[model samples]
Target: MIYDLLVIGGGINGAGIARDAAGRGAKVLLVEKDDLAQHTSSSSTKLVHGGLRYLEHYEFRLVRESLIERERLLAIAPHIIWPLRFVLPHDKGLRPKWLLRLGLFLYDHIGGRKLLPPTRTVDLRQPPHGAFLEDRLTRGFEYSDCWVEDARLVALNCMDARERGADIRSQTECAALIRKADSWTATLRSSAGTQQIEARAVVNAAGPWVDAVLGQSTPDKPHENLRLVKGSHLIFNRLYDGDHAYIFQNGDGRIVFAIPYERDYTLVGTTDQSFSGDPSGIAISDEESLYLCDAVNEYLKHDVSPGDAVWSYAGVRPLYDDKSSSNSTVTRDYVFELDKEGGAPILSIFGGKITTYRKLAEHALHKLGGFADRSWTADEALPGGDIGASQFAGFLAEAKQRYGWFPADGVHRLARAYGTRIDRILGDATCLDDLGACMGGDLYAAELEYLVLEEFVIKPEDALWRRSKLGLHLDRHAHARVADWFAARKEYA
Candidate 1:
């Protein structure tokens, strides 16, 4: 079949583009070389916020766009995205109080703020702050942002795209691109085999491999547009007691975040280091681990070391090389390189944060010109997001009552993970037996079945890590059971 568009990469950008294009009535094919969000998209700081520090870089446009998209994304996918408050303590050095206040004011008003509360000043000597922070810190500002299940956001976009008639293929590599005068032929390889497909246009949203994919299409050109900056995070057992997160400033001008994660852990992270190696199987480096620990130690009274971390993860950001001297100063804003030079058009994406993905997708399509009928994904809800923008809590409350037979915590987890679609998993089950064997904690065979059928989950890691963070919560035996379940099911099939 000749498709309208062939989108390469299954990260947030690729998925978002596929979803938006498909919703506009285009026949789209989205292919990922590996599992969706297995790279940079999943390895994010996992916040949907205007980059507050970007104000210092004078990236006013990027911040405003991100701020605007932040609320839109929250409205469209409230279950996976919701409000989060961050406490930025006013340290004596670092950024001055007046400057911080001015930046916060811009962050609040620039995007026509609504739905979320405005920033407020707080006394660090009081309850939550006093107990968690150091005695030297006396004041801080609490500002609003949103948290995201980063991988799930990518999955939902792919699912929605598939529902809208886009052919979503994971573990499929676009090995070759041969652009014709009127169409482009793509060589796609997978476990099944290799095949050639035709598309009117191609989108190279291959995050870190954008240069590699671009190289495939144009062999003569040396593609060095990407600067692979590795960012790593450490997961510790609940560093502080409050639901709110802390943003700490270092003497070297970098900021680190300590956020509540997965109901039981504190997620601290993200060091900016220049990476020259392969972007696969990346993990937190010792230097990054110590850097993060030191950054946290400078702010929180309870000091921690790299040994205190329960888990660590890393991903390389495919940032556009703006000739910036420092990795941290590299622009988080996206840049698109549209080439209609040789024959058919191929648009390659570079450097964007998760907060502005929706707008990036919209703008990507706009750059591609007549690939769609109309722009429709902005206001429309992604799959399972129809539980009104502001109504997730109500949805969860009602779900707990409806599935009162199930564990309350399980119901809450499912409600947040699947939104109104939780009913599809529970599905008239009067008791636990009807849901099938419990693989671990609240994980049941029923949810697995739904993931396989609806969310494109094929392997155990896809289920435990990307589709959900069950890997962190479930025990090693439970992990084994999940692996066994997949193995047995494959054998039976």
Candidate 2:
């Protein structure tokens, strides 16, 4: 097939690039070695916020752009992106309250924030929010940011790309790429065997393996230099009781976040360590776990440990290398390198974040100028995010009233995950029983069937872990039942 752009790596950058290009009337093909978002994209800190710490590095442009994009995402994907308030307890001896307050003031005025509330001060000794905090802490600063289902964001972007006439090939690897005079030929390896695609342009958006893709995707340049910094997050059962996430300033100059996650758990993480090995091999080290535990214990009254962790995941950040002395000091801002070899251009994306992906995609395609079509993805709503600028609660009530009988849990899950596409999935089914068995909590046989038939989900983990976090709530029996049922469906197909 002839495509205008071939995007390698189905992580957030690749997916977002594909979605934006496809939306703008480009023929696009997205190839992922594994399932979409099965890597670093899924393992994000899951916040759509301006990096408050980046201010220390004087990254004013990055912070300003991120702040703008954060609000844009909340507007476009309200179902999955919701506002989160973070509480940063003021440390008396570390940095003066005035400095912290000044930072917050700059953050508030960084971009013209519209939907989210402004920053405020909190007394740690007071009732409600402070009751759980340690007695030593007295003052706190609260600010606004948004939380995103990071994995789902990638999936939704790919789905939206597919909806807009893009071919999304998951579990497919680009084994080779050869430049034809005015176009490019990508040799793709999949279970079906090798196939060649002709594209006018190719995007190397592979997160940590960007250098690998440069070597593997084409032979023009042996490699493009990028840095892979390993970061890890640990999930523990509820650390305290409030909805607000705790942001702490460690003595080492690194910040840690104890964010409320998945109802019964608190997610804490992100250590910036220089890594030399493959990103796939990077996991939470024994020392890193101890470091995290100590960081959490520093602020909380109740200390935490690895034994308290329910689960943990690690990711490698593909940062643009400016030869920073420390990994933590490396810029989080993205860089684009355009190679106009073989008439067709190769756009290589260096560094970016979940918060800045939409803008990054827009900027990437704009850099590709003559090759990529023109359209604004900023104003566009992603797949399952087409409530057309309506209040989420209003949209929810309306969706429930419209599809009221399709098992309350199933209905909510479908609408929240797929937005308007839920109606198509329901089809002629009028009642709960008509939708099929309840595979688990909130997951129904109907949703699984819909996924296999439409969403390119093949493995149980694809549906359970990435498509939905039903695995966390599902018992062994429920997981097995879903697996067996999925296997039976595949057998018939």
Candidate 3:
């Protein structure tokens, strides 16, 4: 059996492409070498903005497409993606206020924003947003973007693809790809073993490893087409007490974002340094850490050191090598190179942001020259995202009322993680005792079972880190217990 489409890489772009193709009635198969979003997708700054900083680089088209997609994503996955107001403190040393205002104006008007509010000036000397900042910063600009559960977005797309008759395989690598006149025979390698599958076309969405994957084809093509840029972020104990985030401008013509993360921490980061190494096991450099702390210290009343960070993650962006002098100037737009040289179509994806992933998928499929004409993802909701008219908070309130016996934090966590699908995990359970073993924190046996059984969470880290941020709340003992639980399950073995 030949699949209509075979997608490589399990990040947002690949997953989204598979989902889109499957929805368009194509026989799709997506294979990921590691767990979904184990790299770049998971280690993002996690904003669904139109790349407000990209405006300075004159990336108007990318920003406009991203801004439009931002609103569409918010409408489709309201549970995972939500409006986040960002306070950009006016810094005389960096970009001028007039330039910032003009950029914000373009951003507000370009996207056709409806649900999110427009940009406005903020008084930093007042309360809440003002209290934590330095006295030198008198005023700022408040604008809206969005926060997204990056990994979950990938997972949910895979889930939707699966539901639409696409085979979504994780922990599986494409060891070899043989391109025939009309089809592709791909050798897939995993712990289980190697198997060959036929597909009519292939998508090289391997992200940082895209060129490497393309080299694996039967008649290899010389594809040195990516500028690997490392972006590192640090997680600290919550610096402020509000839901709003801060976008601080650095004196070095860069920007830093301090966002309210995970209800307990402040997520700050993203240094654009050129990276040349294995994309896996990438860590925040000492220099990068100091750079971030210094960037934030310029605005904050209280200084933050590298010691303040409890956790840090870094990812290499496989940006399209536009030959820009600085890594920061590289484009965030998606570029699709469709090669059908005496063989099946091979679409290689390069350089895309999360905000424009869905649109990227649409564009990729359109280039492939098959599938349905009508675009469906824009109006559709991701799994568990259809909360009807009441939306996320209202739906959470109703869930709490239904399960009054559950703890408030537990309910909130479950609602936020699973959204409307919490009903499947909770079932008819009226109390905590019915939730099976407590796997520490708010993680129960029921949720773990659902993750393993439904969400392709084979390894412990998949559930602990990617599927949910349970690792942050779970202690060492809990981690061990979860590992043991997965080991005990024969399916995982």
Candidate 4:
């Protein structure tokens, strides 16, 4: 079957494009070499934010667009994306208080100023601040952003795309692209075998490997548009008591965040360094770990070391290299390279953050020039995002009452993870036993079944790490149990 569009890579951008294209009535096929979000997409700092620091680089357009999408994303997927308040403290020698206020003012107003609350000043000597921060920090500003289940966002987009008739194939690699005058033939290899498929156009959204994919298509040209920047994070056992996150300004001009993570831990992170090694093999270096520790140690009342971290993750941002002097100063906005010279067109995506993926998709389709005349995904809620924007708390309350047999916290987790689709897992089950065997924590066989059947989960890691951060909450025994379940199911099949 000849598809109208073939999307390569199953990260957020690829998934978003497939979802948008399929919703526009195009015959779309999306292929990924590995499990979805197994790389950069899942390795985010987990925020739907308007790069507040980008203001210094005069990235007003990118900031504004990201800020606008921030709210839209929250409204559409309130379950996975919701508001977060960040505390930016006024330090003695770094960015001045007036400058911080100015940035916050621009941040509060630039994106049309709706839905989220405006920025406000706070005394650092107050309870939440004084208790967590150093005695030297006496004042700060609080502003809004949003948090996202990064990998889940990718899954939901692909899920919506599949539901819209797009063929979503995980663990499938496009080995070769044979372009013709009017169409292109793709050699796809998977566990089953290699097969050929045709598409009118191709989209190369391979996050870190964009250039490699482009190299395959146009072997004669050098594709060096990407500047791989590695960002790493550390998760510690609850660094603070509040739900609010802190953005600390370092003396070196970088910022680090200490956020409430996984309900029981504090997430700290993100060092920007130019990476030159294999993207897949990247991990938090000892230097990066110490840098992050020191960054947070400057502001937090209590000190922490790398040994205190419970977990760490690293992802390379596939940024568009604009010859920036520093890694942190590079643009986060996306750039598209469209090749239509010889025959069928292929659009290669470079350097986009998760916040603007939906808009990126719309622009991609428009760049391709023939998919749909009107855009439709802007107002559409992703699957299970149908719960009213402000209604998640109420939804969780009702879910707890209806599934009273389950732990209230478990119900809340499910409601947040699956949103309105929690009913699909709970169904008519009247008790915890009804859900199926407990693998560990609140994870049950029924939930795994729902993920496999609906969310394209292929392995235990996909379910534990990407589909949800249950890996952080579950024990090693539970991890082995989850693996065994997958193994048994495969054997039975």
State the lDDT of candidate 3 residue by residue for 238-289, as single tens digits: 9988999999888777889999999999999889999997999999999999
Q: For all candidates, what are the clash counts?
A: 0, 1, 0, 0
Of candidate 4, the 10-residue stretch with the lowest lDDT total is 273-282
- Report the lDDT tens digits of candidate 1 across residue range 127-231: 978987899999999999999999999999999999989999999999999989978999999999999999999999999899889999978877878999999
Tens digits of lDDT, candidate 4, 63-137: 999999998898889999988999999999899988998999999999996888999999999987888889999
The lDDT per prediction is 0.93, 0.85, 0.90, 0.93
User: What is candidate 3's CA lDDT for residue 75?
Assistant: 82
Clashing pairs in 1: none
Candidate 4 Cα lDDT to native: 0.93
Give the lDDT of residue 335 in candidate 1. Answer: 95
> With candidate 2 superimposed using the best TM-score fit, by how many Å does residue 162's alpha carbon deviate from the native?
1.1
Model 2 lDDT tens row, 1-493: 6898999999999999999988888999999999889888988889999998898899999999999998889878988888889999987678678888988898999888888899999998886556677788999899998888999899889888999999999999998887777788889999999998899888999888888877755665656469888889899988888788989888888889989887778999889888787676567888789889999888888888887888888888999998889999999999987888656788888889999999898888889875445657877887767775448777777888888775666666777777777876787777767778877676677788888777778789999888877787789999998889888887888
